[model samples]
Target: MKRVLALPYLLWMVVFVILPVFLMIYYSFNDMSGNLTLQNYAEFLSSNYIKMTLNSFWYAFLITVITLIVSYPLALVISRLKHKTFWLLIIIIPTWINILLKTYAFIGILGINGILNSVLEKFGLMKIQLLFSDFAFITVAVYIFIPFMVLPIFNSINGINKNLIWASYDLGASKWEALTKVIIPLSLEGVKSGIQITFIPALSLFMLSRLVAGNKVVTLGTAIEQQFLTNENWGMGSTVGVFLILFMVFVMLVTRTKKESI
Candidate 1:
């Protein structure tokens, strides 16, 4: 008992996690009328709530797909590099910058008469609408979250035993089949961890999407922000916050079950 190693983290988790959650639970049960009401949950499960849920899920899914498409091979290449320190710096340096700065940079580059449009106009193409649209939101969110996906996959690939690949080759397995069967399975945990990291953040993308896409793209994060900041609806805001937590929990449970079965 004296050597229990998780005690500090456990204490931190209880203080940080349990306390805030308890507060949210308390607030979620109350209504604007100051009476206990299930209306919050009821409203959350309504058609509009369902659409928000689907929209949030699909939006996150799209970001996840884009991140995977872009990051996997980059991670592979970086994982094999001799100058890993330099490349790792390249990967991690962006995270140190203010997220708002990165988000706003997109506005400067994509707004009307911005970089892309300027290049197009120089090439004799007509002006185009890039800002305040779905593309703006998706692009920024993906740019912001790409590192989250890459680092995890890179770390996972780094952990793979080199001898495993050699052994597969010795067994006459082709490169494609070896990668498909051997490398990918071992890295599923890291990929899953990465997806969880990226999914939660991507689903909750607000400032970037708001700044870049304007109001055209409304996400659960932006909705909660609106509820709290713009609408002054504390009860409803807490309800949405609670719903978001439960949604993450549901995803965790599903992923845990699937992983255990695998």
Candidate 2:
């Protein structure tokens, strides 16, 4: 009876998930003439693609690190807050807005003569260019991903056994020592989950690179977009897509926690 009920979901996965992946893999190996070729994969191995891939990984790593740095303390504080749910909801509300809308909002705020620059001008400071730079790109990405990083860590921290912390204090551990040795160590699973959540999406953020960085930043996603949409090279695009999929799977594997057998 349970299997019967799950049949629709199984069918859905076959149609939507499994079929599309197979199609992408098939397209990745075929050239414009529909002839099977390794040319697309070869192009991906060239200097240009390799450099772009490295840049994408670097930016994603930066975004992940920044988000983690900012989020961990914030999550820790929120977990100790009187109204934990309210604060968590506040963090999550921004995610409810469309990502496109959020990105456009940043465009206005970061643009020349925009709110930030106008404030700087009022303070008799130079109107620095904020948009279309690496700083702007990373800042916006961090802002967007912070909530994702926080939620998991907050849950982990909140679920910690208070007795262990008390035991540490009784053993004469300082506050910093307790945090470093006890709390952070136990919450590593949540940190891993947050990294898996944050890093993968950051790697493939095409719209942010285009709209925010003004094409100055070309991520792996941007490369795929250009290949498929601008250059009309679907084969190469699919090849890049395949590589990205494999990389995401690798990240998931690396971050996944192994269960200990009793």
Best by lDDT: 2
Residue pairs clashing in model 2 are none
lDDT of 2 at 196: 95
Instruction: Show the lowest summed lDDT stretch of 10 residues, model 2.
Output: 253-262
lDDT of 2 by residue, 1-262 (tens): 9999999999999999999999999999999878999999999999999999999999999999999999999999998899999999999999999999999999999999799999999999999999999999999999999999999999999999999999999999999999999999999989999999999999999999999999898999998888888988889999999999999999988888866212
Candidate achieving the largest TM-score: 2
CA deviation > 4 Å runs, candidate 2: 260-262
C-alpha TM-scores of all predictions: 0.91, 0.97
**Model 1 clash number:** 0
Each candidate: what lDDT?
A: 0.82, 0.95
Assess candidate 2 and give its TM-score to the true structure.
0.97
For candidate 1, the lDDT comes to 0.82
